[model samples]
Target: MGRTVVVLGGGISGLAASYHLCRAPCPPKVVLVEGSERLGGWIRSVRGPDGAIFELGPRGIRPAGALGARTLLMGGDRSQTQHSFARPEPSAGASGHSVEDWRGCPRPLIPT
Candidate 1:
C-alpha cells in the first residue's frame, strides 16, 4: 500500500502542498480536510454594480521565485490583460448611488 498524508485547511498553502506532493516522482495518497465549506480561504473577489471587480482579500500576487513564478504563469488567465483593471470607464461613478447608500452597512469606508 502507498503512504497517506492528511492535510488540514483548504487554503493556498494546503492546496500547494497537496499539489506538490501529488506531482512528486513518488507520490503518496493525500487527503485534504477543510473545516469550512468553501476553499481558497482568505482570497475573495466581488463584482460591483458598476461592473468594477473588487477584491476583499489578497488580490495581486508577486511570483519571483521559481515555483512561485511557475505557479503564477500556469494559473494566469491569458485572455485577460495584466492591466485589465485600468480600462477606461464608460460612465461616471455608480450612477446616482454612493457607498453609504448600499443595502447593507458598508464594511469598509471607501474614500471618494
Candidate 2:
C-alpha cells in the first residue's frame, strides 16, 4: 500500500499532478474526481466527419524535456499516442491565439 492522493477536478492540471504523483519514485495512489464526465478543463477538441478539426478549449503544453512515458501492465505504452493539440504560434490577437503568450499573459487584458 502507498499514500493516497485525492485530486479534485479532471482538468489538465489535476491530471498532470496526479500523473507526476503516480510517476514519483515512491509513487502514491491517486484518485481524480471531476464534476462533469468530461475532463481536460479548458482543453478540448473535436473532429468533424469531413476531417475538419475544431478546438473548443485552450491550447497546448511544452514539456521542458522529454516527458516520461506512461504504460499499462495489460496494454502498452501510452506515451506514443498522438496528441490532438500542438503548441500554436503566438497570434497577433488574443481571440485568435491558441494559447496565452509565453510572457504568461494573454493579449488585450480587458480592464475589470
Cα lDDT computed for each candidate against the true fold: 0.65, 0.60
- 10 residues in a row with least lDDT, candidate 2: 68-77
For candidate 1, report its TM-score: 0.56
lDDT of 2 by residue, 1-112 (tens): 5689999989877887887788789988899999987988888877666655556775433334334233222123354343333232555354664344446433322112
lDDT value, candidate 1, whole model: 0.65
How many steric overlaps does candidate 1 have? 0
lDDT for residue 59 in candidate 1, whole number 0-100: 35
Where does model 1 exceed 4 Å of error?
46-54, 74-112
